[model samples]
Target: MNMITMGIEEPWFKDPGVADMFGGKADVETIEGTNIVIRIDDEILDLVELTVARFHDDGEWVWDTPDAYGWTRNINGAKEAAMKHGWSEALLRLREVVPSEVVSVLDNIARMAAAAVRN
Candidate 1:
């Protein structure tokens, strides 16, 4: 599904609420021209939470860091660490609360990824 199908939007990705949790706010946008919302689903929200955290903490996403090798490494490390936590631990919990819907969403994504790899 596209981003709107998964509940993703510009504002959500650069969330003030999420930033405030980390002691700041964020503002993500499109690369050029008008902005658009892609996914509108639980998975998008989960991913947005991760993204917002990175942007808020880093203070230099695409805007400030054009040649972001460090940003790449940071996200890579974070993705690895989150993976080390496993899907259940990494994805299902929002604010330390586990939700079955999140698990179901992640399971679907895992299956899709596995199938793509197998193919």
Candidate 2:
């Protein structure tokens, strides 16, 4: 299983209010920048990775699971599947701890990454 751990070096994380929002959920390193770590399961991670790789390679966007074997061409559908799998309970917890604007920023970042993989 792979663990997704991200270090947020954004200046906004230094704010006391912002740090407080995370409470005990995230590890606030210091006033310089805070590191927020969100862990997710391997299946979702693998799906996202595969989706991005296919998108970058301009290959068919189909999730070829272990139990399935077929070349089904569905770029939009694949992208949607990738996006849906990318979302998790950790994101919901992140939303609860961070401001709406911060959440929006994170969401946008996630979407951008997912878009890059999808395209």
Candidate 3:
């Protein structure tokens, strides 16, 4: 399958609030700009496992988290996705932790999302 692999945009992009897969408290406010609240329980974990079980469903299996420019084949589509999913806030928080390229991507997407709402 010639699937176009997608790299993670930032370390905190998936769910920054999730400290770990084990029972960990969410990082509600430490994210600074973003107010994203994540509460992962057994059910959420179960669902996540069903999708991918690379580490044998072990939460401790850390991933080689990537730092890339909001990776996506489509830039405008990424912006629209961020807007549709209320991820602009998360992107704001992610911008602070990622590299300059990542920051620029997130900032651009966020600005576009904001402008889209006004139109």
Candidate 4:
């Protein structure tokens, strides 16, 4: 499985208060702009695992942990997805299974992914 690890060490992005929301070990060194790192690994990473597990059981769990960036990353990704394959029926089905907020972001991400693939 492809494993990706993204981390951010920005002042606002890694704000202690926000970092605490996600849970322990969500903090990175405070800096200016956030940093995101995605890489393939020997095993699936936590983010992918959480998404898959929650998706399978239709669970509702907010990501309290601080990502490299703030909430905007989520929105940006979703929008990118929407610009891609035009949000297919199957993708929508999977997306709908998640919470509305998350779905919104993912819907956009789907478009982004599709567009990236096309390119």
Assess candidate 2 and give its TM-score to the true structure: 0.23
3-119, model 2: which lDDT tens digit per residue? 344332232223224344333332233212222234343222222121211222334433322222222356455434444443443355545544654566788899999999999
lDDT value for model 3: 0.31
User: Where does candidate 1 have its weakest 10-residue lDDT segment?
Assistant: 30-39
Using lDDT as the measure, the top candidate is 2
**Cα TM-score per model:** 0.25, 0.23, 0.19, 0.19
Two-way lDDT contest, 1 vs 3, winner:
1
Q: Number of clashes in every candidate structure?
A: 13, 0, 0, 15
lDDT (Cα atoms) of all candidates against the true structure: 0.36, 0.37, 0.31, 0.32
Give RMSD (Å) of candidate 1 vs. truth: 13.7
- Superposed on all Cα atoms, the candidates' RMSDs to the truth, in angstroms, are 13.7, 22.3, 18.8, 18.0
Q: Provide the lDDT at 60 for model 4.
A: 24
| lDDT tens digits by residue: candidate 1, 1-119 | 32223222443233333333333333333111111222234343333223313454545432221111123334445444333333333333343433444566789999999999999
Which residue segments of model 1 deviate by more than 4 Å? 1-17, 25-52, 55-73, 86-119
Q: After superposition, how far is residue 11 of candidate 4 from its true place, in Å?
A: 26
User: On lDDT, who's better, 2 or 4?
Assistant: 2
